[model samples]
Target: MKAWQITTPESGLRLAELPDPELRGGGATLDVLAVQIPAYTADLVAGGRGGFPLPIVLGAAGIGRVTATADDVFGVRQGDIAVATGLFRSGRAAEPEEALLGWTGIGGDGRPTPTTDRMRDVWRDGLCAERALQPERTLLALPGAETYKATEQLAFLPWLGIAGAGIERAEVRAGQTVAIVGATGQLGSAAVLVALARGAAAVVAIGRNRDALDALAGLDPRVIPVALTGDRGVDGPAILAAAGPVDAVIDTLGAAPTPEPTMSAYQAIRTDGRWVLVGGVRQDLPIPYGDFMHRRLTLRGSWMCSDSTILDLWSMVRTGVLDLSLLDIQIVGLDDPAAALTAASHRHGLEIVVLMP
Candidate 1:
C-alpha cells in the first residue's frame, strides 16, 4: 500500500509504500474510493492548522468500500459501500472527547487532551490511500451507494451531511427563508442546497466572493446572493432587504478577520428566528443582551452530524432531492499529495478537488 505519511508538522506529506491495514477489534479496513481534499489541506499540511500524531496518514472524511470488518464490528459488512465520516467520538457521558482520524480536528471543544491524542494514535490511518483502517462506529453504510456513478461527487456528501445538520439544528422548514453566511464556501454552498431541498422559500446566500455568490444564485431561482462589503450597516440592510426577515441564519464563515459579517446576518433574522454557528470563526460574538432577551432568539453550535443525518443526506442524494451534479468536482490522483493540496486550496462553492485513489 502506498500511503501519504506525515512524520512531523513541518516534514510535509511524503508518499511511502506501507503495509495494508488489517482489521482490528471495533474497526474495519476499507478499500478507499474517494477522499475530498479540503480547501485548507495545504495549510493543514504546512502546520497552519494544529498539531497531530506523527508518522500518520493524513486525510479526512470520504467514501469507501468495506473490505472487511472485525468481529466486534457489526452494522457495516464486507462488500458494503459506506461513508467514513472521519469523526470519532469517545461516547463518554461527560465532555466526550473526539478526533478526526488522519486529520487535525481535535475534540468537540477543538482542544487536545490525552484522550483525543490516544484516539488519533489508534485510528491515524485515514481514507486518503487505496486502503484504510477505520472505526466501525464512524462508518455509515450506504445501501445503494454502489450504483452511484459519481463517486467523486459523492465524496462531498459528508460535508453536505454536516451542513444539513446545521440546517436541521436551525429548524428550517418549507416556505421559510434562510440566510447562509459565507455562502460561497464549500459547506455554505452545501447549506444552500440543503436549505432548498428542505423547501426553504428563499436562501439569502451571503459571502465575500461576488463570482462565487453569483454562481450560487444562478443554481436556483430561490437562491439570492449577497456579497459582503465589510460594512455592517450596508450588509445588514442588504440582507434584510433581500428577504425582509430571514427565518434562520446559518453562520458558516471560516476564520473571519472580523465578526461583523456574521453579526450583520444575525441582525437580519426575524425576532424569534434561529441562528446556528457551524463554522470555524475564531471571535467572540457580541450579542446584544437586551435585544437577545427580548427577541427570544435561539442560538446553537453544531459541529458534525449524526449517523442519522448522514443517512438522511444519502437519501436526499439518492432520491434526487439534492442534486450532487451541481458540484463541479476536480479529480486528483493519489501519488501527488503536494499538487492535490495546492489544487484543493482557493476553490469556492461547487468547485471542489477530490482525490481518487
Candidate 2:
C-alpha cells in the first residue's frame, strides 16, 4: 500500500510504498476513500504542532469502506462506509485520559509515558493512505453514505464535530441568538449551520473577511454577518450591533496571535451567556476578573465531540436540517499531498480540501 510519510520535522513529505497494515484484535482495516486535509496539516508536517513521532501517516479524519475486520470488531463489517472519529483507548482505573488519532498518537493527557508508548503501536499510523487500520472505537459507520455520495460530507466531520462539541458546551438553546467568531473559516461556518439547525433564533457570523461573511449571510436570512475591525474596542461593538445581544458565543479563531479578537467576542457576550473556546488561539487573554465575576459569564473549553454528538450531527444531515451542499469541497490525490497541504493553508471562504486515496 502507498502512504504519505513524514520522516522528520520540517522535512518534506514523501510517498512511500508501505506494507499493508495488519488487522489486530478489536481493529478494522479500511480502504480509505477520502481524507480531509486540515489547515494545520502543514504545521504538523513542519513539526510545529507537537512532538509527533517521525514516519507517521498524517491525517486524522477520513471516510472509508471496510475491507476487513477482526473477529472482535463487532460494530462494523466488511463493505461498510465508516468515518474516523479519532482514536480512543479503553480507560484503566489508574489512568483514564483518552488520546486522539492524529498528533496525539500516544493516547494520554500529555508527555509520553510507558502506557502511551505501548499504545503507540495501535494508533501510530493515521488515515493518509490507500488503506488504514483503526480500532472499532474510532470508526463510525454511515449506513447510506455511498448512496448519497457522502464522501464530501465526511471531510466536514472533524470540524463539525469540534464545533458541535463547543456549541454543546455553551448550552445554546432554541430561540437564543448565537455568535460564531471566525465564521468565514470552515470550522466557524460549520458552527453557524449547526447553531441554526439546533434552532438558534439567529446566527451572527463574525470574521475578518467581508466577502466570506457576505457569502455566509446569504446562506440563511437569519445569519447576520459582521466584519472584524481588528481594533478590540470597535470589533466588540460591531459584533453586538450585528447580532443584537447574543445569548452565547462560540469562538473558533485558530492560532490568533493576539487576544484582542477573542476578547472582543467575550465582550460581546450577553450577561450570563456562555462563551465556548474551541479554536487554536495561542495568546493569553487578560480578562477583567471583576467584570467577569459580576456579569455571571460562563467560560468553557471543548476539545472534541463524543459519539452522541456525531450521531446527532449525522441525524441532522440525514434529515436536511444541516445542509452540507453549500460547502465547497476540493478533492486531491495522495501522490501530491504537498500541493494539497499548501492549498489547504491558503483556503478561505467555504472551500475545503480532501485527499482521495
Candidate 3:
C-alpha cells in the first residue's frame, strides 16, 4: 500500500509503499473508496501543535466500503458504505511512537481522549487510506441517499460536523437571522448550509471573496453577502440592518488573532444572541466585555462534536436540507497531499480532498 507519510514537521510528505495494515483481533477492515483531507487539521498536527503521533497517515475524515470484518461485529457489515471520523477506538497494534494514533474521542469523564487528540491519525487511517482497519463503532453506516454525492460527502464530512455542531450549540430558531463570517471558507460554507437547513429566516454571509459569495447567491437567495477587508472598514450595524436583524453569528474566522471581520460580527450580533466560533481566531485575546455584556450575548465554542452529532449531520445529508453539490470540493490522489494542504493553508480555494489512488 502506498501511504503518504509526514516524517518531520518541516519536511514535505513522501509517498512510500508500506505493508498494509493488519486487522485487530476484534475489529473490521475496510477497503477505502474515498479519503477526505481536513487540510487545516492536518497542517496543525504536522506543525506538532495538535499533539498527535507524528509521521502517521494524516487524514481526519472520509468514506469507504467494508471489505472484511470479525464475526462478532454487528454495527457495520461487508460491502456496506460508511463514513468514519474522529478516531478508531480499537484497531491495529500500536507501535512505540504510534500509540497515540487512535485517541481522538472525548472520554466519559469529559477529558479529550485519544480519539479527540489524534485527529490526523484518525484522518489518515480512518478516512484517507484505500483500505482501513476500522472499529465497528468508529464507522457510521450511511444508507443510500441520492442527495449525497460521494465525492462531495468525502470533502465535506469533517467540516460539516464542525459547522453543524456549532449551529447546534447556538440553538438558532426559525424567523431569526444568522451571520457567518469568512462565509466562503470550507467550515464557514458548511455553516451556511446548516444554518439554512435549521430554518434561519436569513443568512448574512460575510467574507472577502466576492466571487464565492456571488456564486452562493444563485444557490440560495437567502444568503446576504457582506464584503469585508482589513484596509476597508465594515459598518456592522448597517450590514446587519441590511440583512434585517441578526439573531446568531457563526464566526469561522477570529478577527483578533487572524483577521478583523470577526470583531465586526461581534458588534453586529443582537444582544442576548449567540456567537459560535470554530476558527482559531481570538482564542486567548481579550474580548470587549462592555459590548458582550451590554447585549447579554452568549459566546460559545464548538468542537468536532460527539458521534451522535456526526450522525445527525449525516442524517441532514441523507435528507435534502444540506446541499453538498454547491460546495467547492476536489478529490486528489494520495501521492500529492501537499497541494491540498497548501490551498487550505492559504485559504485560496474550497475543500481540497486527497482520495485513495
Best by TM-score: 1
Candidates ranked by TM-score = 1, 2, 3
Superposed model 3: Cα runs more than 4 Å off? 39-42, 45-51, 87-126, 145-154, 231-235, 254-259, 343-356
Residue-level lDDT of model 1, residues 101-166, one tens digit each, is: 888887567888899889898888887888999998789999899899998888998999889999
Q: Candidate 1 has which clashing residue pairs, if any?
A: none
Candidate 1 vs candidate 2: which has greater lDDT? Answer: 1
Better of 1 and 2 by TM-score: 1
Displacement of residue 21 (Cα, Å) in model 3 is 1.2
lDDT of 3 by residue, 232-351 (tens): 244476566757658888888633344456767766777788988776573453478886788898988775655677777777777766767655656567666666566455542244
Worst 10 residues of 3 by lDDT: 95-104
- Give me the overall lDDT of model 3: 0.64
- Better TM-score candidate (1, 3): 1
Candidate 3, position 36, lDDT:
54
Instruction: Write down the RMSD of all candidates, one decimal each.
Output: 1.1, 1.9, 5.1
